[model samples]
Target chain A: MKIAHHAHKDIVIPNSTRHLVTVRQAVFDVIQESGFPEHEMLRIALAIDEALSNIMEHAFETENLKAELTINLSLDADEEKFEALILDSGKEFDPGEIESPDILTHVASGQKTGLGIFLMRQVMNEVKYTFVSGFRNELRMIKYAHDFKTKGATNAGTQDHYQNH
Target chain B: MPELKITTKIIDHDITLIRLVGFLDAHTFEELDVVINDLFEKNIHKIVADLSALEYISSAGAGVFIGALAAAQENSGNIILAAANENIHEVFDLLGLTQIFTMTDSVETAAKAFECNA
Candidate 1:
């Protein structure tokens, strides 16, 4: 098997959950080509899925906007890291505002959602949110190869960072 | 339009074993929800989710089980998760669901879990 030293791909999909599977597959393929372990690749793909789902559910649906919306997604993978950039022209929402829920309390309360951002933060090494007034919201997430190798399938030492620019 | 496929089999006359294949994400979670809801309407609650063939699961898919757990327990039944591949299990582990749900190695073990609880 030949390994691609560096790979970059871009995808644009309507702001709907229907396209999440395709996007996840695309991310997985790119990360696989970069030679990330299957486990790590799955985590990276999952983080991207959560981010996109958040944008669709919270960023667009919250405002009751019915206009046709689209999301721009870019995937870049190399020996050191895999990065995903999601750009959308939806509401200015920062994931940092939501506190991580107590798992016991959350499940006991009969809540079915609100765990996407938490999962994204757990899987990605960096999750930065940038919004330019009157423009678009950009969410950048990166997972480092070293982090996954050291952390051993858990987010034990991973730190969650969010930035608004 | 979603990529998930859900098939159900009744085991031990009461437990419904749902085998999931393909991706279960925001697009297809509602299908699982509807299946569980229909079971609840029929007063059947003991469930063992056979996930050996399930390739992926996202938060939305996990939410269906979280949302149904309470109702199943209140009805003197339970939901057991079985044979989740490493990736699928990681999603549950990430959400702290491992502590809340009983996961087994096979459908036989999961079916016995319902018996053990009973």
Candidate 2:
């Protein structure tokens, strides 16, 4: 089970909102090079941005340690998959414990929290979180290249791929 | 500085039309929040967000609307979405905002909703 990739890039930046554009541009460049459609490319970038925001909001809370966040972008040629891996040196948190926002109820009540995780789970084909040793966390977001192809598969009816832990 | 431009147009003293161009994410969303808050302060409750040129929006951008819409509803107004691209629509749909928002094909039609209600 080997999936060959065509393009790959690794980026590291400080844990700050200002660096979101840097990460988004890198993911956009890689996704563009992978020949993914422009619209889907933007969506992927948005998902990656949300993940980065989550790291800044929760993981880096309580203290602004001089830390760095790593983002890895890769496209599998054989499987036509695009994946982004975000690693952070922030507090350990459980992604499974986050519930999907009752969007309707929440919207009716004016709550903005919880939509970041929901967007990550909804936009990307797959999203996973892992807690590495000692205050390290990795969030993975994946999208199928074919899903954005002009004549490729429609995203409708695709099974949810977000996993716990 | 985020690469986003927001232009606001006040119509009829009750409706505020905002045009969003470029991307909306955590960094750039504050610009939107500021404009919406200013509108609320002025007692302008109804809003129409023109997203025809909006290239991207993260969840935080969408969250801005959640708060704006709720406030509008409380003030007997509404936030109408107009000309959203498929990508923007997908995010809105994923969050089930379609049911919560009144989406129209054009700003003309969205503006008419306010007229009809009035």
Candidate 3:
């Protein structure tokens, strides 16, 4: 099935260390409705992770960095794709240029820091980022159903129309 | 509004146990990284993430694990995930993270494993 069966969700989370998951669920719905597989959902989720995590770690500096962050989830009706955008008025940090650590070798050797954005690229078809108003960082990613590839009758819980591989 | 709650503590020496009792997504994710990373800075070599209370973990949350693992390694430490349910466990297995991070049924087991290796 195409993204014609797509849906969307949006939310605003307080810029506190305690509010990251509320944002992730919003991104989850966007990816789920796009008809993509589980892997894609994780990738889009990573992008959001990298961006939001940076804010909590660096932007706040002190405990008073309490601000407001907004997240939006939308689906494309024609292309069978899902999109999620996160907007925050935190300091500027470019996830696009952040060097991703090699997780394969690290995890194998029992070591692990730089693979956050790398995995995001792996599952997402398109990832774009920009900083507006010098304070608001916008991060977005798209997932296509063709990547994971499912077949057979998808009697798997929520995803009724989409089948298994 | 009793949305999601996160609790953290040190269990069995260097292992910092972060118990996430709610959803894992954009809103609550960074809090984990910040707290865990802070613990990482103080040289907490072993991390056990008890997700038994977590009802949902989005892809972004998975990325946080990857990133945290990497950070831990940089500091000569490690992060292991424990008590993941079917849905969250499926997310981990699909991303091949089940292999990357040790997955166990209980935090006690994870702590024991960490101590065993240490």
Candidate 4:
């Protein structure tokens, strides 16, 4: 199947903790517009939230950094993919330096940090980060439609129920 | 802005049951962290977080609980999660939190676990 439908959105929010709520809501609305299931939407939202949080805490590193987070979400029906490109004007940090914390050991030691990177990886099908230019970083996250779709289901059919625990 | 409303009630002397509403991300996680720390400082070890109303969570929110687990456990108490929807559970599962924290289907069950532990 090719992209029978598609939509794109761009959101710019101040790089401050106060604007996180606004960013999450705008991104959630875009993801919902793609007509994905709720579970997938939550995952995508969580990933975006974590990515933005990382940028705010680590990239900006100050309360009043005078920066903005530019996020673009693209939904492609033909490719069956939902993609988000988050661009920021912040310091460049190599993602290779971070490792997923071992939950048992990390918790036993009372360490509260380091789950952000891990969560981003798990929630999205693909996550890529790059320094496009000086003071500019891009983090692209994508989720495939089939990951939430059942076998032999039509593309027009939307999954309504979440996999309840 | 992303919002998180935390309403707390004390049950069984030291058991604090907190209802979380709205989104818990990097921005609003500190609210929960401060609340939990305040409870711990008061020697309240048992905490049951009812997350049914919580619409979303990220690593920051999850970290707050992990960060407090040791302190809570040291005082013979723990953070019990109740009524987490599949989305939250999936996030918890990603970090192996299901194995680290006590998760129950209902707040009553989570509270009862504290009684048994006590």
Best model per DockQ: 1
Give me candidate 3's TM-score against the actual structure: 0.54
Q: Please give, for residues B47-98, the per-residue lDDT of candidate 4 as tens digits.
A: 9999998887888888899989899888888999999988888889977889
After superposition, which runs of candidate 2 have C-alpha atoms over 4 Å from their true positions? A1-5, A35-39, A62-79, A146-165
DockQ (CA atoms), all models? 0.82, 0.73, 0.19, 0.75
TM-score for each prediction?
0.92, 0.84, 0.54, 0.84
Residue A86, model 4: lDDT of 78
| Chain B TM, per prediction | 0.96, 0.95, 0.90, 0.96
lDDT of 1 at A25: 84
The total number of steric clashes, by the backbone 3 Å criterion, in model 1 comes to 0
lDDT of 4 by residue, A44-162 (tens): 77777777778778876555544544434333322367778777777785453577677789889888788877777766666666775565777777677776544433343222211
Over 4 Å off in model 4, which ranges?
A1-4, A35-38, A67-79, A147-165
Local lDDT at B38 for model 2: 93
Better of 2 and 3 by lDDT: 2
Report lDDT (Cα) of residue A67, candidate 1: 41
Interface RMSD against the true structure, candidate 4: 1.2
Error of 2 at A33 (Å): 2.2
Clashes of each: 0, 0, 25, 5
Report every candidate's CA lDDT: 0.86, 0.75, 0.62, 0.74
What tens digits encode model 1's per-residue C-alpha lDDT throughout B14-43?
999999988889888999999999999999
Cα lDDT for residue A162, model 2?
36
